[model samples]
Target: MLPRNTVDTTVLPPGERFGMWLDLVARTSAPLRVESAHAADFAARADFTDLGAIQLVEYRYPSLDATRTRKLIRQSDPELYVLALTTSGIGTSSQDGRRSEILAGEFTFYDASRPHDVCHHANEPGRTRATSIITLIPHAALPLPPKRMAALYGGRMSGSEGLGALLAQFLIQVTGHPEQYHAVDAGRLGTVGLDLATTLLGRNLVAEDAVPTEVRRRALVTQVQAYVHRHLGDVTLAPRTVADAHHISLRTLHRLFEAENTTVAAYIRDLRLARCRRDLADPALRAQPVQVIAARWGFGDKAHFSRAFRAAYGMSPQACRDGAAVTARDVNDLASRVNSARAD
Candidate 1:
């Protein structure tokens, strides 16, 4: 197993910090060159080996000028493509006549060989917490036109929705549980990586229709489901809005859902009910009125919410909430009994 590698520049001078960064880059590939206005005070860690086709790295740094950062990237690895998820701080990058500002909770991709700049500003001095998962993959592996990738290079892609959400969650999980993964899992993750990259590229290019029929169909359904779940609070949300978001006809949207043995309306209701069920079981909301919780999850009529809840769980809404409390206590008691038995 590969042990995690971590480095904190706060403990080292500028020269030593740059030297450590160089050593890290060299460990994976050729030697890297470094340059900066004032040397970077940064920290980074890697938890996996480079034996896999792709490598993941987590890095953080304070605010810096765009020109200097681009220069460093170019000198370090001119042929690699870098996809960065900015967790904090604000930054902007420009390429191919397109310029975009990346704020927290967004992602941007760039190529090291291209001359691009990124400027970062912290909300407060010495308080920047920019967590990025940088994936290094060969240019040929992308399987998309260079122009299409460049079009998306500096733009903010939504990481909290659909495939982006799945991708972000996977990266976060692996960052914490790198040891649980093996070489086979890494290869599978690479396939997912390509799917995500392709999806993002298709969105940027306005050429989703150009993707293979099955892949496009699956991606569209995923995007539609995400949209529905996000807008459940809006009473106006319906099949029309879902179709409008993806620029498809309502009839076609229904056809897509039919493939999964569902209609859009049924799917939305099921999702809303699931959300309400979760809220009813939450201990923190025990004091809140059940009607308020129902409305919060898009159930406008209290009577209707109760009927639906009972139909789904075979118990009234209030009874279901009470049952959750009993279940929690029973689980606690069972755990105690198991511990006592183990001790005996």
Candidate 2:
């Protein structure tokens, strides 16, 4: 796995929690003046992951207000661009004379070398905490001009659809399940993140035509794959539908997946089969009919699904489920025997 370290303020004495957090934030992130209502007994946690040229930090804390002033910048400037995506609660940011309210499922950009104000709070009742994932990218690493990037300072960006959704989902998945990725994936993941960020920014600025063709292509492929994964259960989902949704030609879509060394239909089929195979092995779904499980994954023809399952797993769906049941029974019987022996 990539190098990751977690810091929790709760581990320190209540009186020292906020101080330690402040220092830690200054070191891991940029220098800033930070305040919190829970300062006396601040409860916060953050995970910092190093991804080659970039870094990702996931934070969970109570209401906070932080300012990156000229003094702080003069004290230590990282010359980095920080993209703050709030996963929960609401927040506001100000930079370059622009202030924007960023709600949950939204993000904003700020430059560490410039002055900015950020506040994270929950406007809803009964919610006292806020969560966010921050991405730190060095200014030199970004290909866009500073003037163009400056226009986005403190601008609200939605993570609801298009490139924004893909980037948001990617960050969330990586932070939520770091164990799923390996150290070898760090550089590749970082490049993908940069590409997606560049594409999103370029699109918003109406300068996507200026982005490198290869970067745009990679970002589009990633978006298409995400879309396919999300609509796997839709029987109407096909290569043409995927192409249309992405506003690309069917031939172009085929070419994109070709670079991945797979056809669109084959990709969808493999994913559906994988889902069906997993469901068959799940004990909770044991009582469910095999056809129902297959149909749920867009496999309309029972015989076709059965044939596909057999070809993929070398076993019929019923046989796979029965095998899982036998294994489960064996484990349970062994456990019961061990308990009985201990009782005697």
Candidate 3:
């Protein structure tokens, strides 16, 4: 992510600022009629990031009116869903004959493919700028029904609580702290973003079942994986137990795992083995016996644990731990090494 542009109307001959703003907006977003005083005393800036499947843009600007007219719709209709999250501003919007009043800490959606009107005004004049996060989501990327969502356009939605709050929190974190995530994980983040958005819309409409099965499945898989990792020390963490915890049937849980090319039991075993591998290498746990280590990771039977550990690491747990003894954090300082690799 990088700063796309910074336009301070104050430096310009007042008259040229509004025209330049129009051109800039026309190139980045849809063409709209911008209404402001002739003084052109406004100032604005924007930053954009290309997050695979979605475009995230942060805008800081003064109060203005943006109107999308029929003529502009005829000029071009970019079928995109724009979500405007107001961070510090008071705004009003109208679409589909519905009007909504919004304040700071709120969000609303508008269809870029149709006509709409927006009025963004500042709450206090001395603020840095009326900032907002605008997410451009393609029509095909959203899993919820479009018409159903359209009915919600131009309505004030709470982003301060519930699922919408989670979505809002995630957006703020990802955009504000990009270093916390890996670049390779951008696509996954996008998927989660869409799922949260769909779930939020479904909840707002009081029709969660309308959310697509794929959307729900992906979301459930994410939640279940976290739950499993958190409770991996429990020997009773079996497929039936996991299914019950999630309020889903055992068959459905198994099917969800299968979609990821594994079974519920296998996923648990792999994670357990991973934890065991990490523990066996810990210098503080060197005095601990292999049986104790195995039990710590939920492997109850001694013989079964030994055989499974050998099958997974090509060596018994004891042998692996003996070879894993190290005094330093890096491999360059390691006294011995053992290849403990497994595919899941």
Candidate 4:
């Protein structure tokens, strides 16, 4: 599992919770004057993942307002690019004399060297807390020029599609599933995240030519990955089609995956099998036929899919699903017994 530091303020006293939370944020990223309605009885948690040159933090808390004043900046500055995405809330930020509204599934970029105000609100009433993820990158780590990058300060970047979406998803995945990766994978994932950010910024500024060739190539590969994911349901999603869709030669496509040490077919097949495996484990989909589930992920033949799934997972699809069902039943039974004991 990747290294992570988690701080949950709920363990502290009501009065001390907010203070501890404030101190955690200041130490992790930068100092800010944060005020929350729930501060009197605050409950919040943060998961911090250090990715060498970059840092990713996921914050879950009630609605709050925070400000990084010029005075605060003068007192302490990290000289970092803070890109925050609202995963389950509505937010607005002001910087560079501009105020940008950040709806759910959107992000805002700002510099820690300057003053900014951010307000995050729960998307609807009765929600316990709003959620967001922040990616902190050193100013020098990004390949884009400072002057051009400045144009994006306090601007909304849609996470609904394109490079912005890719970056947002990358942050969520890296922070959410650190256990799936080794510590050595952190720096590489950070680089990919930074490359996606540069691509998005450069494309928005109409300065794609300004981005380095290597970064551009990596960004193209990232885009290709996204494209393949979106088209995984299409049985015709082959290397030739993928290359043509990207307007690149088949040989170039092969070369790109070569860097990842996999062929295009293997990549696509692995993804499909993984998806199939996930669906099979889903209790709600228990009634769904194995053949139907297989076909849903571009597998037209059950025998071929079974063989591939066995090769990948070392178990037949039916056996995998059966194991999941048994596990789920055991968990539910345990919960019921615990509840009964509590009632007694």
Q: lDDT by residue for model 2 over 178-257, one digit each (tens)?
A: 89999899999998898898888888778888688888889998888888899999988899999999999999999888
lDDT score at residue 204, model 4, on the 0-100 scale: 78
| Residue runs of model 4 more than 4 Å from their true location after superposition | 229-233, 247-255, 261-263, 269-344
Q: Least lDDT summed over 10 consecutive residues: which range in candidate 4?
A: 21-30
lDDT by residue (tens digit), candidate 1, 213-323 = 655666567668757877997766788988988789999999899888989988988888888889989989999999988888788888888899888889988998999
TM-score of 1: 0.64
lDDT scores of the candidates, listed in order: 0.68, 0.89, 0.79, 0.89
At residue 284, candidate 1 shows an lDDT of 90
- Which is the better candidate, 1 or 4, if ranked by lDDT? 4
Residue pairs with backbone atoms closer than 3 Å in model 2 (clashes): none
Better of 2 and 3 by lDDT: 2
CA deviation > 4 Å runs, candidate 3? 1-19, 37-39, 124-126, 221-344
Taking all chains together, each candidate's TM-score versus the true structure is 0.64, 0.88, 0.64, 0.77
For candidate 1, what is the lDDT?
Answer: 0.68
Residue pairs of candidate 1 with colliding backbone atoms:
66-118
